[model samples]
Target: MHPIAQPRRRQLLQAAALGVAVLSTGCASVSTAARPRVVVVGGGWGGLGAVRGLLATAAADVTLVEPNEAFMSCPLSAHFIAGHQPATDFQRSYSRVDQLGARRVRERVLEIDRTSKMVVTATQRLPYDFLVLSPGVDYMEDGIQGYAEARAQLPVGFRAFEQMAVRQQVDEFLAKGGDFVISAPKPPYRCPPAPYERAFLIAEQMKQRGTKGKIILIDANPNPMPPAIAQPILKGMKGLYANQIEYLTDTSISAVDMGKRQLVTSSGDVPFAHANLILPMRAPALIRQAGLGERWANIRLPSFQSQVDDRIYVIGDSQGTPLPKSGHVAFGSGQRVAEAITERIAGKSPVVSTGAVDLPLGICWANVTHKEAININVSGTVVAGEPPKLKFTVDAEANARSGAAAVSWGNGMWKAMLG
Candidate 1:
């Protein structure tokens, strides 16, 4: 070997050995020994947000526990009901999340073992240093009599992946032409404007297809719940679908006789050929089983830390916050919860105290027609001594601009969630 080359080779070997030693020492450190494990339940907007954030962190070993193989968005699902968009447009793959090093488990969480800090699934028990639950909402079947048994026919397409079922029914209604009844439940449900948007979109289809049918929208509240978007929603209903949609306020579907196709309401028994009963919603059964709360998981604001269980963080529509149950709020809550977990792992104090964390933000849309929409933006803040205050900024009326923006937002959000 050349004299200079021999020295250079030795130097290269020493550098390689030093690099290996450093890597080994780094791996042996307690902080790197086992990266904090974060298991996120549900793969909806909120869950995806947490997973993405955790993946972005080098300190987290993220595991996404979702039963569905793919994600389907509840937002803009009205278009599917109206046949303007296909079901595939909302469905997204989990492959991107998997590629990000998140252990994607396609299994439903059976129970949460708070004592062991493990989530029990059918196949395996997942151990997590931090847990985030965003399982979304479930309908309260007790409010309306005979609803549980007739749930199949009376599709409540509020949840993701269930929109296709309602869309099929709506398609049949448009083809056959009958009384298409869409009922809106009280406030605090998932997507407050969804039922109205569904009505307007379907009514637009009715006019274009000449379905010879009128949409009967029975709202539980006197106007719209949360009151802020009432003017815009009512304006859309009257101005856009005046002839095709009939708005009934202060009326609720108390009971449903599916065999007879009649709905008993506060006003009176209404007969309908096809119906979409958006039932009252509550937290998923797992939440109550885990002793979270009756209607929702009682969480400490900002931290999203569960009041019942400190190790668990509940975000999205599943938590009992006075914020609107929109995808925007869910996504924001997910990111907030992930950051809180990261801070905890780093042994750092929270930027915002558990007593006074900023409330989640909400962005919801109501389609007045096929080409126009009403948008609602909500910002909430929590003070040390006072309850959370939510402010709503709504579009004056439905317009083509908002309609186009809604679609763009949907595309961007879906990309953020799945891409």
Candidate 2:
């Protein structure tokens, strides 16, 4: 052969050999069975994070089991309750998840068979290699007498779609110009500043619409719990809507008379045309049924693995972590848990340390007015020998910029969840 031809022939031979090796490796890795199945409960923020992460890997078969057909966010939902925004602004459909090849089961999870690693629904049993639960919080109705029977008249609207009921009541109060009573439960509920935020927004509405009603804000605690945001919250309440809103501290509602529209509290029997009784919250019933903690699931930080079941991971507001129950933290934790699960499946043992692991990141928004809000960002890190340290960066006060950013963030998050 010519010199150039001889070189070309050798290069062709080498290319063929490389191709053969690639094919051989591919064949060796091919398996007759499918990838491991992962069953995730709840389609809220935390569950969406896990589902998205697992789908991005394209290594696991994901099954998302949620009772609701669509996902409505609890964050930014105060606007909906205050009638500033529509329900669709905070609600989203799961079409994107379906397009991403996830098996979407629109059914409530009935039970968890840990021994077989199966999640039971009314219609089907989903077997999984791993299970993730983020079913969110449930109201502690027993804490207040007559709450269960009077549930319809006194709407809490703490959860997703329930905001509509509260909004209806607020509208009636606005139209009729009567006493609008909004009560705040004790600490460690869904959002610390939510009840106050609700009050501020509604007060703004009352001022704008020329409603004659006075808003009675009853607080079960002396001041706001989780003292960090107390000053700003109180300032917003006292400085902004002192005329339209009444602040009643250290007052607890003992019972409610729905027929009379009267709340018997430690202070007095207050009658109202409208009432929103924000009830105490706890982990969903599924958590307790699975032998997790009675109120919330006990989870090991950084790892997010359940204390009772090592094979299961629980994140978000449902877990009884010292961290704030914010959606941002829940999403971050879901990603962390996904990484941990992937690492473990790869036959790599997680590095055990006597030190602490980093907790989830939290971002919260408290709307002070229609065009302003207080933004809170909490970042926590665990030290080698110390407990997790949380640092909060809050906007000194509500501003137009932060308020705009809050709306943008809500839009972005809703897109990420259901887009």
Candidate 3:
């Protein structure tokens, strides 16, 4: 060995012999044995944010528990579903996250053993000093009668990896040129404007292909959700897709008749050549099984700590907060929860949120065409014991600038989470 190399080699050997002296992740260096264990459940935007933030601090023994081997962005996947972009454009490998020195568990959480502070998987039990749950949303198939049985045919694609099936449905609809149905559930679902966005993109495709059919969009709400971008959404449907789209408001799907290829609704029986029924959504079953909230995880605002257990935190759409269930908000909440955990691990006193505590800001885009979109931005603040107040700023119309910004935002967010 060279004179300079020998000293570094000896130092490395001594550190290895100590077993927990130093582990460097290019971000921070700390003793492995002295760090608190943090188990993050899920690998979506929220969970990825928590993992990255925690790893940056080198404050916890982070373990990311996710079933999917790769990450997919549901934020701007309308381009993929509408055939304007390929699925690979929105998919990325988990290799970047794995390279950060966190333990990556490729398994679904079968149960959360809160009493034991362990996450139960099929083959292992992961014990954690602090747990961050960001399992995202699960569809309420029971909301629409007979939807459970016909789920394979009607893909919601709100969650990751499910977009491929919905893309197939869209592909057939564009090729065959027949009546296609896209239903939007009531408020509190993931991405309120997604169903309308999907409709608009497909309608744009119809115009391009000169398809001989129309898209029937049924909404459970009186208008487009959040009531912020309803004007622009309606205007787009009426102006650009007047002949190619049929808008139905104040309607709900009662049942799905797979045998007849029809939807039994409050209005009447509606037929379709292809259907993408975005059903009502709630937190996944793991939340309720773990004694979390019934429909969503009960979490306190400004902290995102569980109401039942301080050792656990829940972010993303799974938590029962008034925040918009968009990727931006989920990732922001994850970053906040990570900071809270780092403080606790450092033995710092909790900051009393007596004054106005700001929550995560929400940003979402509704693409009226593949090249034009309407932007909605929501900013919220809350007191210690009061309901959060949310203010919305939405574009009055869709434009090409917002559409371009949407793509840039997606790319930047993905880099932040995985890079």
- Judged by TM-score, which candidate is best? 3
Model 1 ranges off by over 4 Å: 1-33, 352-357
How much does candidate 1 score in TM-score?
0.90
Name the regions of candidate 2 deviating beyond 4 angstroms: 1-34, 353-356, 383-386
Worst 10-residue lDDT window for candidate 2 reads 20-29
**What is the Å distance of residue 258 in model 1 from its true position?**
1.7
Best candidate per lDDT, number? 3
Write down the lDDT of every candidate, Cα atoms only: 0.79, 0.78, 0.84
Better of 1 and 3 by TM-score: 3
Shift in Å, residue 97, candidate 1? 0.2
Using TM-score as the measure, what is the rank order of every candidate, best first? 3, 1, 2
Clash counts for the predictions, in order: 0, 0, 0
Candidate 1 lDDT over 136-255, as tens digits, reads 999899899999999889878888778888988999999998898998888889988888888988988888888987899999999976688889888878877899988899997879
- Model 2 Cα RMSD, Å? 11.2
**Candidate 3: how large is its RMSD?**
9.6
Q: TM per model?
A: 0.90, 0.89, 0.92
